[model samples]
Target: MSEVVTRTERPAQRPVHRPVFLTRRRTYLWAAGAVLLLALPFYLDRFWLQAGLFAMAAAIGATGLNLLTGATGQLSMGHAFFLAVGAYGYCVFAGDGADGLTGLGLPTWLAAVLAVLVAGVAGGVFSPIAGRLRGAYLGIATLALIFIGQHVLFNARDLTGGYNGRDVPPLSLFGLTFDDRELVVAAVPFGSAEKLWYAGLVLLLAGGLFARGVLRGRPGRAMNAIRDHRVAAGVIGVPVARYRAAVFVLSSMYAGLAGVLLALVFQRTVPEYFGMTLSLDYLAMIVIGGLGSVSGAAIGAAFVSLLPQILTRYSDLLPLVSAPGTGGIAPGEAARYLYGAAVVAVVLFLPGGLVRITARRNRPTPQEDT
Candidate 1:
């Protein structure tokens, strides 16, 4: 016998949406931050402005390194090599053969673009090796780049100006040269630092946004898959080697752009600045901030880059720190010591990096039954 049954219809549930105010609040915060950054150069002295620019440039490079080392699980100790290529490449392309140096006399903007490309090419040349290796093996292969770059930078006298390095041609964009020409805005005298402040902000913002996109897109998923399990990723039809190579090139290009910005800010391209130490600092940035996170890279870059400057600027006011060469725990040394301790503390406790703190705080609480 067939059983008699009745069916009860339920009302359709609406899709859950976040509170409108939450989105509005984020937009408002972003607007406030942009306004603050734009206004900073007007009130800040040159020293502070320069420091901020340095931080921004470092953040860009660190972001790229994070994409490779953190996201792809590829260790790179040759980031400084690409940066050197960019810095020196710009000097060559824009130098105009002045001061007995070789140059193509190209437009400053074109030179910057070409410099980034040159860096990408450099990475492409090494991509095969990166594709084949992983972990410490890849790192060791990349480390050789630093030595090779050092030799080229020192010996290529006509291109690099030997040990002294070369002057960076002031960037000229749309008839306004980013030099110490003393342009005034709102009664405030604007120099290279002031002009480059806005440029640095723009570059950093663009880089951050692009990185965030990559991190959230399909490439990011493939990268994470490769990172988590290379053989499994390959088995799933992901081109693990190709992705690794592409990411390496992309990371190199980012470092190159950062190098160009740094050269513009300093008005010079020095070989000594782009070294193993700089690469290590970039690693420290990603690790201290949060691996595989753009905001984390920026935050870590700011902390790592600014700490030395802050210590030096206010050494007298702080204990266990003094002016450079004055002999009582020099500010630079002290800064390093402090960051080293911070790294240890972070590894021991906050393995997710400083950004995790905010993430943990922002996480929603689970509701309890009444």
Candidate 2:
């Protein structure tokens, strides 16, 4: 009766793999970067802070461009027009009828929000044409926007202050005004730049996260599909035209927000500042950074925006670079040349742009096959 065999069960084996997203190393790196950013205002001077603010603005604008041009395959040459709208719109909405400029006398915070909305509305007005056009045709169509915008900016003296432009009203929020008024924090003099440093960080963080979410979700898939093959996207029930128009408006809103930050930094909004050259620079940023990549856009923006500043700061020490109007290659021109070469090199060899280099280093390699 005792012939029953005692069977032994093997213990369950644990899973060998961990989730690739947000791994320990990545989490640590992000934490370190955040800490560094938070501490920078205390250590760095105003020059560096302003330069960083410019980079942040550029990043915001470039991310929007990438969404439309890189992800959706819609070429836009009038991004600067929307930027101008935002800058001038804020001045008009917030100004108190001073210096021969028109003003709605709204609160600064409301003006900023309305300025962004105005940019979106401007984009919406152009959507019909954008939805129908593609490739070079679309680009050419958008070029007209620059000319039209410039004309209006010059002629609408009360709104844009004509050739001279207009001053940007200081932004206020939650009982704190972002101006040159000195407020000490932790023994640090928090002026407009210092105060705006924190504001810029928050805005950049929010914009990047929102953009990342959009790219990682269903809308991004639809956009990529439309970019890859429009007819196929439509066949698969994607509303190609509607999506294109919507993206244009969204991109314009982003540019608007960037313009607001820039206006605050400079305390002035100039038509010349938002011109074809600016649009071209943004295109260069996305191209050099990586198409359809959020981080790439930011990286490219910082590189392009900072190169000139760095060169100017050390122009005397650097060969072939001199201060503006010094007969040698100007700092801006030098930076342009360097980045122009970088763009060509990226297109020729690294089609994926700078982001690919980072991705490759971070990618894990497989061990020997069993």
Candidate 3:
């Protein structure tokens, strides 16, 4: 007799519909953070506010650099040069041709926009080189930008105020001035640092969101493809050179915005601050935070930028750190050493950087049943 086989039918499973945006826990965390940020200016002093502002600016710059070097695999060593361009560009656009400086005396808002554009133009000018070169070659070529920028910043006194630098005109938006002039709000005196704190927050939020969108969109996919294999990406019809150049311009604009915020925070643009060291610091930030990650860049920026400030604040309690000129390792130097070691350690151990640590902690481990 012939044997008959029966087919067993399985029950259909419904697709799980998870929320695309924030979950309840994340929303609560975000709300808490916002409340804290809103209240910080009232409680924190100028020093802490200034330090936070610096971290915000660094985060913006690092995010841009991450887009280029980290996500796109394009080596860039001229990030600080773009920052200098933005800082001085803002001065030129906003200055009233006073103090023997050349300026257009544009509106503060217009000046800020123009400064960002100027940085984009500067990057475009270098795009040919950026588009053609890759890896260490591109990095070496970009290194020239720092030297050239330094020379211009020092010698072009009319434009950049030379070695002594120039004062940054206060930013005015909707009649509110981000200046040292105190504006009382909720019984708290809001000075330049305090006012700029809000401005910095706005800028950082916008910049981070925009960069995240870019990273999560079609452009991001193309960039990743080019990063993973340039030849294969090109064969698949990706415009390798154009994408590289465009990313360079975009990255420069981000740096430019950061420079403007930094100038506002410092109230002065010092040529010495935007040097090779600054560029290296940006590189270290991306490496330590996590390459190809927006949150990683921001996290790295805060860590690196805040380390020196934290060390200085508690130098007496720390053995290896001391105030500047105290003979011991200066806080800045100590920060550098710590981050340098972190960079090496991350590369050797966690190739994904510090972001992976958080990821690992959040990941659930599989359980084995006996």
lDDT of each: 0.92, 0.92, 0.93
* Residue-wise C-alpha lDDT for candidate 1, range 73-119, written one tens digit per residue: 99999999998888889999988986889999999999999999999
Error of 2 at 272 (Å): 0.9
- Candidate 1 vs. true structure, TM-score: 0.94
The total number of steric clashes, by the backbone 3 Å criterion, in model 3 comes to: 0
Candidate 3 TM-score versus the reference: 0.93
Q: Which has the greatest lDDT?
A: 3
TM accuracy, model 2: 0.93
lDDT of 3 by residue, 220-311 (tens): 99999999999999999999999999999999999999999999988899999999999999999999999999989998999899999999
What does candidate 2's lDDT look like per residue over 30-93, in tens digits?
A: 9999999999988999999999999999999999999999999999999999988888888889
TM-score to true structure, per model: 0.94, 0.93, 0.93
Poorly placed runs, candidate 2 (over 4 Å): 1-22, 368-370
